[model samples]
Target: MNFLTIFARNLKQGPQTEAFPLGPAFTPERLRGRIEFNADHCEGCRICERVCPANAIRFAKTPDGMTFDCWHNTCVFCGNCEFYCPTDAIHQTNDWDLSHVNADKFDMVEHGLIPNQKCVECGATALNTAPVIKNAKPPLSAEEYTELRARCPKCRAKYLKNRKVPA
Candidate 1:
């Protein structure tokens, strides 16, 4: 067809696109757009730290506590961390509104993680105060080697509660 004829045909057809920043839009179901972490469920094994292909995931710990960084700007979203998580802690949420004006704001947090809260039950240390272990597996498994992994005596008893009433 001639250039003029083609141009006229194109102009006759309406724009087939969605308007943005003015109307509510729908994100596709299969479209991957964001990552999320549940800090409470995070046992700080840092398997996510190990499996990340982009080197975007990082962790830091002092005598203080632990924190995780998704670094979404650099993350390729391979979901390596999500699959490798033994305890099913780090997984993606369906909230994909991640366009941020500030570069640092892309750091999506589990937020309200109490890194400084003291262990009220024991004078020793709480999950909040300290997160990671110096050695990966201890001789005692923190408190004891149980079927459920590294759970302290007090925590275990609370978990394995007596459902049956004793006469």
Candidate 2:
């Protein structure tokens, strides 16, 4: 077509670009964006840290407990850490709005803490994470699960071992 004809046709159609800043931007359902960490559901396995290709995730021992940090600046949004986490503690949210000034670059981090708790039976301190109980015979009752959560690893194993299985 001629330039004038093509220009007329283009003018008839509205702007094809997204109206972001004036309207909500398009976000896909599976868009890999910001990282989120939930210490409560974490198993303290540190698999997320090892799987992160960008080395954005780090775990450190602190006086209070273990601390988790994921730097957004360094993260490539590969979702490897989220996929490798066995307990679903790490997740990638759809909020991809990471625009920030130079001053705020260092603050773009997702942080979490797995606090230490005293074992009810052994008086030992351990991370307050959900116990990994995949092989409980008839499934643990709420009370039994609560009791299991209150002990150390060794005591929890013992409790599970001594549990009377129903016929």
For lDDT, the strongest prediction is 2
Model 1: residue 63 alpha-carbon error in angstroms: 3.2
* Residue lDDT tens for model 2, 27-48: 9998999999999888888998
| Tens digits of per-residue lDDT for model 1, 58-116 | 88764555767778777777878888886667776556776777865655544324253
lDDT of 2 at 33: 96
Highest TM-score, which number? 2
How high is the lDDT of residue 16 in model 1?
A: 54
Error of 2 at 60 (Å): 0.7
**Model 1: residue 128 alpha-carbon error in angstroms:** 5.2
Cα displacement (Å) at residue 96, model 1: 3.6
User: Model 2 TM-score?
Assistant: 0.88
Per-candidate clashes, comma-separated: 0, 0
